[model samples]
Target: MFQDLDATLKALLDDAAGPAELQAADVSFDTPDKDYKPAQATVNLFLHEVTENRTLRDEARVMERVGDGYTSRMPPLRVDCTYLTTAWSAQAGALKAAEEHHLLGLALRWLSRFPIVDDRFLRGSLKNPPQLYPLPTVVAQTQEGRSNGEFWSALGIAPRPAFSVTVTLTVEPFDQVEDLPQVESIQITSTSIPDPTLAGRVLDHALTPVPAVVVTVVETGAQTTSARDGTFIVPGLGFGVYTLSVQAPAKPVEQVTVTYAADHQTHTVVLSGP
Candidate 1:
């Protein structure tokens, strides 16, 4: 990922800084020695530090559906890579300082134009596999590299003008995960059972049918009173075990468990009491 960013920056500089070719190299802050000879201009991108973007940190695990099971994986980690960018010139003369300063200005302008590097500019493995967003780029003064005095002192070199570039990237986790079971579809089976009809007659002790006797299904709370003929019928009830309750005047409550059948015929019950 760092290599990709560096290459992209180099491409941008080479395209913008015309006439003189600029090469991006991983070098220290100390100016190149007299024995070393580089192109007319060089952009040194020194990766100095890396910091985690805590705000992008997430505790929730990522889940994906694979076939009949779900695969779990850790969330991607976000980090900011800081690069110390220093422009150099091979020319040695009174105008060498001015030439290096001019090259640096051009590099800064070119970098400023791209606050974010588009995905098309990305190369290598970064172009495929894990999905990533356009990298955000920022050229600014860093607290650690406030001045050339302290910055160059840390590198054990003379002071020189330089800027900081930070590119934020999202990196996937290195761990592998196993797929787990997940419910895909639920199957419901229905039988063509006949609806039930409960019918009963209420009678007094004299064996005469008693009208107005309330017959209720205890499970469903469905009740019906006997007609003038002392007969009651409840239809369209599902086939199941139910408690049939019979109540009339001057008679104690009676309850009986009846397992309804699929015959679709009326179930008859006879009740007689005081």
Candidate 2:
């Protein structure tokens, strides 16, 4: 990693217009003493992110360290540069031969403290070394409580909240996405019985269905109503058993069948929320 960083730094230094002497060094973290291992915890970096106009004032503390530590500090980060910062994790137990096996993973963060717009450092002057973004938040998802079987168990249920995905993109303005029209339908799912008593307040997990809720009868291709409280009544039906499905945005699909009674068919299915 040092070799790669050295080569990249050299490449950028030669391309610079000015004749400024640039030096590179590595910053390390200590645990009371240098020999102790920092296992499975917040690796703090008490680093600075200085820019031309403004700077991130807050100081962050971190534990883990990666080989490619300071790529965004110099080089192509000159001015008006736009790039993505990626993070990696390493197993901290053993390097060569003997060590205890531990699930201790460490976080690696690459930040762009200075958001380059043009040939200009939006945060700092292009003349000096750039400061990477102050807070490179890594989502710490440890398998602390849940077992491996829980993940596998999700598959057994017909339509259980199985998996989640998150995608992040840096854009000039976030509202630009709201303007786009719905050529394709996006489904957000939630349970019909949102609250037993509370009227307005919704649990943090459930989403208030926007546009409308989509209820589809698989065999007949029939669609129905979307009430203010998000309920649809299916009527004029003979004695039949069918699977009813409901879904919404960024939510799990829910399916439960009901045998319509001759008098009244009132059935409710619970979607495991959040």
Candidate number with greatest TM-score: 1
lDDT of 2 by residue, 1-274 (tens): 2222223323332333422221121222221122333342212221112222112232232222334231111111111111111111134434311111111111111111112222231222222233333212223222268443543343242221111111111112112221222233343433233222101111123344333445556556665634555556654445577766666446666666666554424554444565
- The reply for model 2, stretches above 4 Å from the true place, is 1-211
Q: What C-alpha root-mean-square deviation, in Å, does candidate 2 show against the real structure? A: 22.6
| TM-score against native, each model | 0.55, 0.23
Per residue, candidate 1 scores C-alpha lDDT tens digits across 90-198 of: 6788677876777677667777777887666666655665445567888965766455565566666665677888878878865888677786444332324444465
Model 1 segments beyond 4 Å from truth? 15-39, 65-69, 144-148, 178-274
RMSD of each: 17.8, 22.6
lDDT of each: 0.67, 0.31
Error of 1 at 101 (Å): 1.5
Model 1 gets an lDDT of 0.67
